[model samples]
Target: MANIKEHLLNTLEELATEDLKMFQWHLTNNVEDDKHIPKSRLEKADRHDTVDNMVQKYGQIGAVEITLDILKKMNNNQLAEELRTKVKNN
Candidate 1:
């Protein structure tokens, strides 16, 4: 298996437009804290904003690292696998 960072970064880019929007909303508003989407982050990411909000919302260093890792190695098969794994885990 690949290193955790490589695996995650290579996988993160698989998130669809809606998935990315939800992720941004969850991060900026702290879904655990807000329990609902934050419109600001949603709009920002939809408007093609930065990944900075993800770092701030997730706060767990591992999440950001993994996202970067996944985004780095995006591919159809990898994205499909990553999505399957993520959904199962969630």
Candidate 2:
């Protein structure tokens, strides 16, 4: 199984630029205040940086669940399900 970082990167790679922006926005805004990734930080992050930051802030499982939540908020249920399946299989 791929590591969590690789899984996150693979999932993020599926998004278009606009969708990625929306995903980041949701990520930044949807969490409890203490758990939020700063908009300033997310603004400059590429996929790798984004994944690293998420893992740093939330740990692997929390980061994956947060990503799933953001994806669902963006109406990307298919991607969320795909990511959940991948994580479960691993």
Candidate 3:
């Protein structure tokens, strides 16, 4: 079985550039009970804008690492499995 870091990197590798950006947006925005994006910045915007914001706030590696950290902290099997499935599907 893959660990969190492995899972994230593998998923990152599998995703297309646009999909990866979307994933980054989801990491920073969606995901209930977990707010990675600041309250001030949560106002509606283009999803692509979120990708640019993530690039500024977290950079590529930082985005992946921060997301992995959040997912680990959440410790929800369903969420984790869903992410794994998304990774596989994409």
Candidate 4:
């Protein structure tokens, strides 16, 4: 059987550069989704506020785990591994 950790790491390595944008986009969307405000009202939200909201909703580790899961589900293994390493080393 393939090692899931290695597979995830390989996927991260392969797509890390390109998939970063995709991951960030998804992260932003996911964070926004948790907001109670209407989508139409979110236009005034600042980047820092949005990120703060995400951390508020998920905490640091939880937010990272959620984003990693999102990347994995989207078949963005390379980017996921890159994030995993960042989190691990930080």
Better of 1 and 2 by TM-score: 2
- Model 1's alpha-carbon lDDT is 0.46
Better TM-score candidate (2, 4): 2
Which digits, one per residue and each the tens of the lDDT, describe model 2 over residues 13-83?
Answer: 99998998888887798899999999999998988888998999999999999999999888999989988
Which has the greatest lDDT? 2
Candidate 1: lDDT of 2?
48
CA-only RMSD, every prediction:
8.3, 0.8, 8.9, 8.9
> Rank order by lDDT, top first?
2, 4, 3, 1
Per-model CA lDDT versus the true structure: 0.46, 0.90, 0.53, 0.54
For candidate 4, what's the RMSD?
8.9
Candidate 2 stretches greater than 4 Å from native: none
TM agreement with the true structure for every prediction:
0.37, 0.95, 0.38, 0.49
lDDT of 4 at 67: 61
Give the distance in Å from residue 82's predicted Cα in candidate 2 to where it truly belongs: 0.8
Q: Report the C-alpha lDDT of model 1 over 5-78, residue by residue, as the tens digit.
A: 33344444456776665445445454355433356645745322333444344543545443544343333455
Candidate 4 per-residue lDDT, tens place, 1-90, comes to 433333334443454444544544555565446533334333444434434444566666665677678778788676778777766765
The parts of candidate 4 lying over 4 Å away from their true place are 1-50
Q: What's the CA RMSD of model 1 in angstroms?
A: 8.3
- Per candidate, the number of residue pairs that clash is 9, 0, 0, 4
